[model samples]
Target chain A: MSFTTPTIDWAAFAPIIIVLGAGAAGILVEAFVKTPATRRTVQLALSLAALVASLGVIIAQWAALDGAGTVVMSGMATVDRQALAWMAILLVFGLLSMLLFASRDGGGAFTELGATAPGSVEEKLARRAGLQLTEVYPLALFAVGGMMLFTCVTDLVFLFVALEVFSLPLYLLVALARRRRYLSHEAALKYFILGAFSSAIYLFGVALVYGATTVTDVNMIGTAIVNLADADPLLLAGAVMIIVGFMFKIGAVPFHSWVPDAYQGAPTAVTAFMGAATKAAATAALVRVMFVAFAPLEWELSWLVWAVAIASMVYGTVVALVQTDIKRMLAYSGVAHAGFILVAFAGLEGEALTALPFYLLAYGLATIGAFAVVSQVRERAEDGGVGAEAVRLGQWAGLGKRSPLLAGSMALFLLSFAGIPMTAGFIGKFEAFSAAIAGGAWPLVLIAVLASAVAAFFYVRLIVLMFFTDAPEGAEETIAIEDGALTRVVIYVTAAAVLVLGILPSGVLNLFADASVLLVSVGG
Target chain B: MNPMNYVILAAILFSIGAAAVLLRRNAIVAFMGVELMLNAANLALVAFSRIHGELDGQIMAFFVMVVAAAEVVVGLAIIIAVFRARQTISLDEPAELKG
Candidate 1:
């Protein structure tokens, strides 16, 4: 028998190739470059260039993808408006977060000597000599590349691969904090174990689906469901398991045990990047799986989605109300935001699709901005050196008196998180609720509204603590500010974007509406 | 000899792995639990491929193996880091950041 190779479309695959290729080259730089300072500069420059270049390609392809979509690489990936929108968001988030990573207040966010024990002489010596783990740049690029692929893959196999590719880097990055190595390492271990466990279940689900449907391609799975005479129990079980995997990534209830710890332990920069980008990537993939591959089973899956959404909202809000650590609070708040995005899935139509990407963009911008503010506020060491981030809510007392600009930005982000009027979060909530209502899911929206109200209390509490409260008596630990141009740019851009998107959402709303359609088939 | 039996055995192995992950206190053993689960998935894939009369499932099993291998590399590095820091591989030791 003669075999013919399938024709490949390299142009459709350029964005992923460029990002991953740059990541591999970055690894080479880490090995060959002698000086840590020069290696960091090279890595930072290459990473920014790669992300910006990918964004350029995505924009150039955006207008061309008007109708159904292009299926490339023998049906492994689909290049369409939905994928393009997520790619743009991920690339933008990557570029902005790279700024946060490269920003240095001497120690920056990453450990100087990751392999050395936390308080050992070798660690201190390495710190004194000013060593930096420039390897983080390549890991971030790898994660970004995986996220881009996660949103666009057309097959379950590719889905699993993308899921792991993104996850492994994050697992490593979570452990690289310059301070609090113990907590960081522990968090990484928990995240790795739990993440791997969830993915295995997802793979098993894929096996069951293949057994029931006789196909591995997601589009074919959808077709198989319609072509089959009856819905197999195995098929439903498989779907739920696959969704369990996605929920773990999204940080929904029951699967959200990892979020708070990981968020609290990871360096602020990594948390900011992962919080904004990972949720977007997972939500994009979830929408494709639910809308494109499992559209026919909407009636069966609706209740599961609603249950997870409601539980996530309630649990996230209630738990966040009691959190003392700012990062942990933000992590719980992120859980609630994930629920809000999932609520749109209650409406399994184009409207929900339109709402999610827009909501992700709005939420992502505010999150990255808030974390940038978190990174700026440092603990003052005895020798006048800058320590780890000041994470305790009490530590933020009277911050407005010292750094009004930083306090104001954090307050703005909190307002956005609360979905208050005149912020991007408000617009995000409006579209999500409206879409759910249109789908006849008003009860879920009502529950969501109540959770948002409860969530608003916690966010407002932080705001009040920052602006209104006096520094407690003998609270000698002052909040030290590290001036970095990179972080300053991130803060200003995010703050301004939040206000602009809040004020004029029509332009982006229309884009999301137009790009909501999924091109889901084996053929282009 | 039947493929259905092999699928059942894989399911049992997967359950054990899940139990180990949930109940084990040792980080290394917990990690081994995850590895077991991945291998179980590979087993199911091969069994399913045999019944379906196609090689796609077998190919998927290969991919799973490679992924599992990579995961082991990363997982071990993390476990080693944790062990060096605390002088223990027990999951219960690190209790600094908890609600």
Candidate 2:
């Protein structure tokens, strides 16, 4: 018997290939490069180059493929404007985060020797010698590749593979922080156990969905459901399980127990990257599954989405009010932002399609910038070696007087998080609420507005503490600035983008609107 | 016996695995629960493939095994590291990162 081979389009798959290749090359560099210093430089350069190269390729492919919606490997993967837009957004964030990752003179944010016990003589010696773990570069690249693939895959099995690809690296990265090693390790354990559990549930859901429909391709399943006279309860059960998996990734309430711990425990650079990129990637998949594959069941499933949105908003906002730690507070704020974005998801219509990507972009920039500022504000020790970040809310009082630029930037990001009028968060909230309103989700929008007002109190409280309060005695220079050009670039660029995207939103809004057309079927 | 029996068996196994994960305190045992859950999904896939007269489900089962193996490597590495540091494999002991 003659075998017919399925034709593969390499050009359509270039961005994923380049990023994964860079990750592999980084591993090789670690093995071959004798000097740790050289390996560190090489890995950082390689990661940045990979991200930039992928961005360039995405732009090149955008014009001819814009709105074309081509399915590359039969039904395995689809390349469309929606996937392309998300890919571009993820790559930009990845590049900025790498700069944050590699921005320090004394071996940066990661532990010099990750396997060494924290506070041991070996660890102290490694720190004094300024050893570095260049492996984080490759791990991050793999995560980026997985996230990019996650946004575009049409097959359920491929989606699971992509989910694991990104998650495993992030679990390891969360454990690599230089200080608070126990906390980091604990967070890593919790994240891994829960994350794997979620994936298993997701896979079980996949099996049942496949069993009910006898198909693995999302579009095929959608088609089968459309043809069936009565919808199977098994299909609905599978859908809810899949939604839970996505919610876990996005850090929505009930499934969000890991968010604050992981955020507080990880190196700030890693937190910046994962917070923004994971939300974008998971939201992309959620939208694809809901709008493209499960559209017919919108009425039955919309209530589930609404309950999650409201729960996340109310819980995140109320809990954040009492958090003394800035990272934990930001983590809760992330939960609330996830809820706001879920407002768009609950709409599950053409209007939501327009609002979701723009909201992710605005939210991502503010988050990365805020975390970059956090990374710089460290506690000054007697030995002149940088201590861990002073994250307690009390430590931040009178920060405005100490460093006007950093504190001002932090305030800008916080305002954006609060949905202030001149920040991107405002536009994001406005678009999301309007979309929900148009989709007849007015009550959800009203609750969201009330939640936002409640959330504003904490953000303003922090701002007040910074600018109005006096520095608690002799704590003037305790908040040491780790001054790095790369970190500053990350802060300035995101802060500027937040303001620009807020005021002159038309340009980016039109771009998002153009890329909002999702292809449900192969080559639609 | 009917092929549907295998599917029912798989479902029972999956529920037991889920219960173990929720109820168990030991990190390794909880991890084992995840493995059991994955294996149940594999069993279901194989049974369903037979009923459907296709190789797709069998192929997916193989993929699941490879992914599961990789997961064990990472999971064990993490558990061992935590155990070494704290001298306990119990997840309940590490209450350092709450709320």
Candidate 3:
């Protein structure tokens, strides 16, 4: 038998290609580049340029697309407006995060040598030599590329591959924090094991799905379901398992044990990247799986979605209320945000299609911006030098008095998180709640509203501490504010985006509305 | 031989693997559990492919194997790094970050 070759649409696939290509080139640079300082500069420039170029290509493709979208690579992937929108959002996040990664004013975020033991002589020597872990740029690119692919791939096996491709890099990145080396290592180990375990479960689900339907292409599976007289037990089990895996990535409850540990343990810059981009990508993939592949099972799966969404909101908000550490608080807050995003899935209606993307965009911006602010607030050493990050809740007291701009930005992000009016979070929550209402999932929306009100208490408490509370006696000199140039730019961009999207959301809302169409493979 | 039997055997193995991951404290053993889970999925895939008369399941099994191997590399590296830092690989030992 002769094999026929499937043609690829190179232009349509250019954005993913550019980012992954840049990642491969970066590895070569790591091998060839001699000087650490020069290598850092080259890697930063390369990563930023690649992300910007990919963004441009996506915009161009968006303008050129006429129909729903085309299935390329013999139906292994689809390039639709929905996927393009998610790709653009992820690229913007990558651009901002890359800037954060390159910021070195406060001794940077990643360790000089990942292999060296913390506080050991070799670690000190590496630091003294001015060495830096510049490989993060490439790893981030690989992750961005994988996440982009994750949004668009059509086949279940390809989806599994994309999930791992993005996850592996992030697992490694979590371990490279300059401070709290042991904590970072523990986080990586836990994240790696749990992530692998979830993927295995997801793969078994995929296999069972294939076994039940004799097909792996998502659209084909949907077609098979339509033809079948009854839903096969294997198919249902597999679908649930598949979604469970995605839930772990999204950090939803029952599968969310890793979220806080990983978020708090990772370097602030890497956390910012993962917090923003990973959720957006995973949510995008979930929307696809739920909407395109498993829409027929909506009746059966709605309860699962509702249960997880409510659990995440209640559990996340309650735990976040008591977190003494800023990073850990944000991690629980992320879990709550995951629930909010899932709220759009309640009705499985068209409005949710627009609502989810907008919600993720708003949430991602606030998360990245907030974390950037966290990275800038450092601990003051005995000799008056900046040390590791000041993560305690009390350390932030009277921050507004010392640096109004930083504190104002932090306050803005916190308000956005609370879904207060005149911020992106407000519009995001409104759209999501309205979407759920339209889907006839009003009860879920009611619980979500209650959760939001409770979540706001802690968010506002932090605001009060920053603005109104006085620094405790003899603690006035404990917090040092470092003006890292790159971090400042990230904060400005994200905060501004948050406001613009909040106030004049019509432009983005309209764009998301137009891009909500998912293209199923007709060939399959 | 019924190919369905193979699928049932795969399911049993998957449960054992899951049990090991949840119950075991040693990092290496937990990792082994994950690998076993993956291999069991491969068995199910091949068995299903045999029953269905399609190459897609077999091809997917190959892809899973390659990805699983890559996972082994990364997982071992992370476990090694943790060991070097703390002189132990017990999952219960790292209590620094409260789950």
Candidate 4:
């Protein structure tokens, strides 16, 4: 038999191509560019340019789209408005994260040498030589590209590939934090083990699903379900396992053990990037899977969503209340927000399509901006030099008196996280809850509303510490705020976005509504 | 022997791998368990591909093998880093960050 190669639509794939291509080129730059300073500048410029160009291409694709979307790569992926919207969000996060990564002279967050033992002679030498792990720029691009693919891939196997493409880079990046090397390494190890285990489970699930359906394409799985007289146990089991894997990535409960550790242990810049973009990518994929592949199984599968959503909301909010560490608290808060996003999936209504993306955008902005604020506040070392991040809750006391701008922005982000009116988080929560209500999941929405109130307590407590309380005696000189220009840009942009989206959400809400439709390919 | 038996064997092996991952403390052993689980999935894929007279599952198995190899490189690099820092690769060794 003669085999013919499938034709590729190059333009449709250009966005992912551009980012991953830049990532590949970055490896060459790392080798050839002799000077560390010059290499960093080149890598930073390359990463930013690639992210911006990809964003441009996605917008062009959005405007020029003729129909719902086309199945590109011979059914390996789809490029619908839904995928385009997610891609745009991921790109924006990528751009902001690249800026954060480049801030503080490209060496603020990451270690001087990843392979060197912390506090060892080699580490000291690397630091003195001004070596930066500028390779983080390339790795971030790969992750962005992988996340973009994760949102759009049509086949289950391709989805698995996309999952790894993004996750591997994150695993490496999580370990490169400059401070708390032991915690960073531990977090990386745990993340890698759990992440790899989950993906293996997901792959097995894909295999079983392929066996039952005789196809791997998600839309084709739906068609296969329609044709079958009864639901196969294999298909049911496989679908649940696949979702379990997605939940692991989304940092929901029972599978969320790694969330706090990784978030706290990772460099704040990496945490900001992962917290925002990873959730958007995983949520987008889950939405596609639920709407397209598992629509027929909704009645059977939704209880799982309900159970996880409730657990994440209750557990996340409760645990976050007592946490003293800023990063750990935010990590738990992220778990609760994950629950809020899942509430939209309750009724499986079309409205969830719009609600989920908007919620993620709002939540992501607040997350990145808040983390940027965290990155700015440093602990004062013994000799009066700037030390590692000041992460304890008490350390933030009287921040408003010292750095009013940073403190004010931090308060705004916390208010937004608490879903107070006049911020994006408020609008995001309203949309999500309304979508759940429309889907006949009012009970879940009620629980979610209560969780939001409880969550507000912790968020507001942080605000009180920042603005209302005074620094304890002899602690006045403990906190040092770094004036990183790039980080300030991120904070300003995300804060402005949070306020604008909250006040004038109509345009964005309409945009999300219009782009909510998923492209369903048939017959493989 | 029936071809379906291969699928059964794969499932049993997957269970064993999962159990090892959850119970074992040694980082390398747990990592080995992950590799076992991946290969078990590959076994099932190849078996299913044969049963269906289709090439998709076999092609997928090849992709899984490649991805798994890449995973090994990263995983071992991380494991080595942890070992170098802490002098042991026990999963329970590091407890610096706690709630």
Candidate 5:
């Protein structure tokens, strides 16, 4: 017998490895060289550096991506343009989160809260009174690194491990806010327990999958299933188990109850991370599993996804309408968006998978920015209330008069959510819908459109409040722009990109097409 | 030892461990269950390698063991911190998250 060792591609793994390495180093720096100022700076600087390094690597990968991704390191991972796109989006979200969380509690434009708020002496004084969320950068970055690794993982073992790495950090971040420990802690514990349960279920599913195929490599499983093309109960069981795990993680319908609670109870910055990056990773990994390994079983998983997607859409929209709290409404709105993303999944057999990447980018940016605005508006602890109570749509009354920039930004995102022409959100949904329609999924498209219309009501409701209502006496409290320059930069860029993509969507459409072409999933 | 017998025993143990991880709420028990599951997998992988006269499965098993150790260590620390702060290991009691 002869044995040959498969070469590992350390270079291909560089982008993710860098982030993980930084996370470890940042903890070490804080542990040994500990001072409050140093603690903040070390965590903040390390996080920014890690993401920046990942971005630089992403640029290099993009430049070289003409037939670029090769299965590296004995086929442990496949580095492709899609992975690059997902990582890029995650990194960008991390950067934006850092910026949005930039300010400290002292009176500054980028305050931890109401720093740049409107109103006279009273509102400013009130802004000064709100509770502060400190050292959010390290936690946010830790989660980002987890997400970036999740996108690049090629095999199932690596996939599950990476998922937990990203997920655990976020569970902790939710509880770590200096103020409002009770709300935040409770949220964290709930998220941790359930998230861990979901992960264990996911891992067991992976185990079953390994048992069925007698193989752990994902692409190899794809090869095995296609080669056999028969009803191996074990294999089917494995596939079913794996699909259930993925389904739960993405918060599709039955598994979605955890989402709103986690989103509403978590500190806003943590909420932003979970809303944007975690969902992106979980969805991206799902596409990798179903579309990549189980493409042969499309006959099976497709219908299941369709049912979940439809339920998610209708449930999300209906529940969102009656919610009085702004964050809760957005939480339901998120559930609806999850349905839209899955609608793209329902067409997994063809050009529809292309929409997955672009749709995630669009949805993530808009959602992150929306949450950022929410974080900024909620009142501080010193303001003599629990963590910010500013969610009522009417509370946004007269926002246009006071903090025009914040209101305008919120309006832009809301319109994008409404899929108004010319914003990235519209382009994203349009592309996904077009692909679904191309796949001859008329009913799904029609339902998706109707749900979009229903969902639009609440998104526009906030707009009317922002533009019409007189800023409730306290509504003029401007959101302190956090000092993290990157968060604001990301928000501005995404908000602007929303408009730009809306205008010349063809460029993005072309990118989506080319990117979609490379997906080795069911259709392409 | 018969390699096939080892494989079957490992599979049984793996299932038992997975069930424990799923059905139990005590953090330490869950951690022990995870450890059991990983060790069972390692045993199976090693047994298969001995039967097939291969090294790949053995190496993979070794890696799994290493990761299991790391996971148990970190996971236990986090659970401990949570328990210390809240003074309870009953996982069902932390249900304040509903909006």
Candidate 6:
């Protein structure tokens, strides 16, 4: 082997560069800007600008994704189109979340039924009375940027850094809620500890892989392992360990214990961020490892992953069926969804790999929209104030009779979760299951379909609660909000996506096929 | 120098860490155990890097250490906050948010 100087594609890395600049700018704005409110505005604007730039880069790359666009950075990282696309999606998700958090109580019901038109003196006065905090935008963007980088990271070091870059801010995100501070605090603690443990396991796996194969560049490690497969015990141990760590992050059953508490306790906004983006990052990283690096040993590892997939599916769906609190139920549903997504990776077949990214997008959008709605609906207590507790199904008993639109949207999301035909979940589950079947994984595919049915029961139950079940006595029937434009937009767009993708999944499926399947013929 | 020895030591250390994560109740203790596992991994990585005469793995190990350090600070701070909130660090007792 000869030593060579590394080359970088700065243009390809434009999104990341822009985000880092925004993060720096955010810190500056935070320090110099006097009011937290004013600083939040500037910081959020900067973050949104960074996300917009990320979107632009993604579009540019999508226009030119014919070849594997590798911007090798000192032989450490690459700026590829697949990663850029995932990042672009992440930034857009971040932007939408920021929009929801941007408005002053626009989501809270005090801001809802309490005011008239903005031009009215009453509305203006109410606005002047309270200062809303929306500083989560910059932190969210930095986290999004880190996740974007996480998807594209070609080297081991970049991978770990990207993981932490996103993880740290997320801990704070959990603790930011106003109503359920204790729950948030506990959730943050559990999440932080579990996350740290998983990170450690991941690093340990990397170390063993390094020790056995004596290489760290994933491409190099894969090659060395292929040659040493019969001789290297360390490589085998390391591979299995790394897979376990990733399985935990993606909430594969048995390692999924923290998800429900974390999701339920964290603010709904933060839950959406973790529910969607974390899965994307974990799935992307796993694909890069499984398909790109260790594609050779697919036959052996596929079984382990398949077992996990089946377990996750059954566990998530069955547990969700019995949950009363909406958030905890959604958490279980997220777990089951992770299983469905992982089922797409039960083998190294090209079709299966393609389904992986598409499944993430479908699941991300659905979970994000669901959380957005959860954040929107408010219930007023006896003292005459509204908050998140108003989001319960009991309070939502007469929702259809009150605000038919919100009820209908909630119904669509529920139907989507059930993978009903004409929803994105349907398409996502179909493609993932079909991919697994194509890979000759019939039994696991059957189990996945069965688990979907189980999940459907809970999803349908929610629909019944929204449409058929009568409101409990003393419960609020109307959905009140302080601000809700962004939530409504997210709800409708995600619902429409579910329907469109369900009705005609072929287009997105084809796009997924065209996208790099995280399989880059490494040893060639 | 026996490579098997290095690999064995890493494995033993990792198992100890895993046991700690599973058996310990204190969040901070579990965190420390996780750190030990991480260090064991770093040791294996460097050892393997030296054996292979490769700089790539060594470089990667450096990055892993940086991430591990960051995770510790943030993780410890979060644990401290929770302790203050609930006056307990035992994972078994923090069912206040459980489903």
Best by DockQ: 3
- Predicted candidate 3 versus true structure: per-residue lDDT over B38-87, tens digit per residue: 99999999999999998888999999999999999999999988888888
lDDT of 1 by residue, A1-524 (tens): 69988777778888999999999999999989989899999999999999999999888888666575677775588888888888988998999999999999637889997898899999999989989999999999999999999999989988999999999999999999989888899889888888999999999999888888878788888998998788778889988899889988999998999999999999899999999999999998998889877888888999889999999999999999999999999999999988998899997488988899989999999999999999988888878888888899999998888788988988999999899988999999999999999999999999999999999999999989988998887674566877778898999899988888899989988888878888876642
Better of 2 and 5 by DockQ: 2
What is candidate 4's CAPRI-style docking category based on DockQ?
medium
Interface RMSD of each: 0.8, 0.9, 0.9, 1.0, 7.5, 8.0
Docking class of 5: incorrect
Q: Provide the TM-score for each candidate, comma-separated.
A: 0.98, 0.98, 0.99, 0.99, 0.84, 0.91
CA shift of B52, model 1, Å = 0.8
**lDDT tens readout by residue for model 6, A1-524:** 89875555677788887887787677777668866557666876788788887788777877776776665463356666567657766876777666655634433312311113323565456457553344466667678878888888766656777878888888767766655566777888888888878877777777777667655566766677678738466666677777777777788888898899899888787888888888888888788778766666677777778888888899899889888888888899988988887888874457765677777877788887888777766755445565454545566566677667777877777777788877777777777888888778888888888888878998888777777887766554344643466567777787677677778878777766766544243431
Q: Which residue pairs collide, candidate 3?
A: none
Overall lDDT per candidate, in order of appearance: 0.90, 0.88, 0.92, 0.92, 0.70, 0.73
Off by over 4 Å in 4: A105-107
Better of 2 and 4 by lDDT: 4
**Shift in Å, residue A139, candidate 2:** 0.4
Candidate 5 similarity to native, TM-score: 0.84
| C-alpha-based local distance difference test score of model 5 | 0.70
What lDDT tens digits, residue by residue, belong to model 4 across residues A1-524? 99988777878889999999999999999999989889999999999999999999998998899888767875688888899899999999999999999887324899989999988999999999989898898999999999999999989999999999999999999999998898899999999999999999999999888888888899888888878789889899999989999999999998888899999999999999999999999999999889889889988888999999999999999999999999999999999988998899885557999999999999999999999999999988888888889999999999989899999999999999999999999999999999999999999999999999999999999999999999898787887889999999999999999999999999999989988899887754
For candidate 1, give the lDDT of residue A177. Answer: 91
What's the true lDDT of residue A27 in model 5? 63
Q: Which window of ten consecutive residues has the lowest lDDT sum in model 2 chain A? A: A515-524
Model 6 Cα lDDT, one tens digit per residue, B1-99: 676577569778988997998899998888888888888777777777767777766677677777778788877777776676567889778778765
Sort order, TM-score high to low: 3, 4, 1, 2, 6, 5
- List model 2 lDDT by residue over A1-524, tens digit each: 69987787878899999999999999999999978889889999999999999999998888777455677787788888888899999998899899999888333778898878777788889878868888999999999999999999998888989999999899999988877789888989999999989998888888888887888888887887787778789788888888888999998888888899999888888999989999999999888888877777888888888998999999999999999999999999999988998899777377787798888888999999999988888888788877888888998899898888888989999999899988998998898889999988999999999999999999999999999998888887676777788899999999999999889999988877888788766432
Where does candidate 6 stray beyond 4 Å?
Answer: A1-5, A106-135, A229-231, A477-483, A504-506, A517-524, B1-3
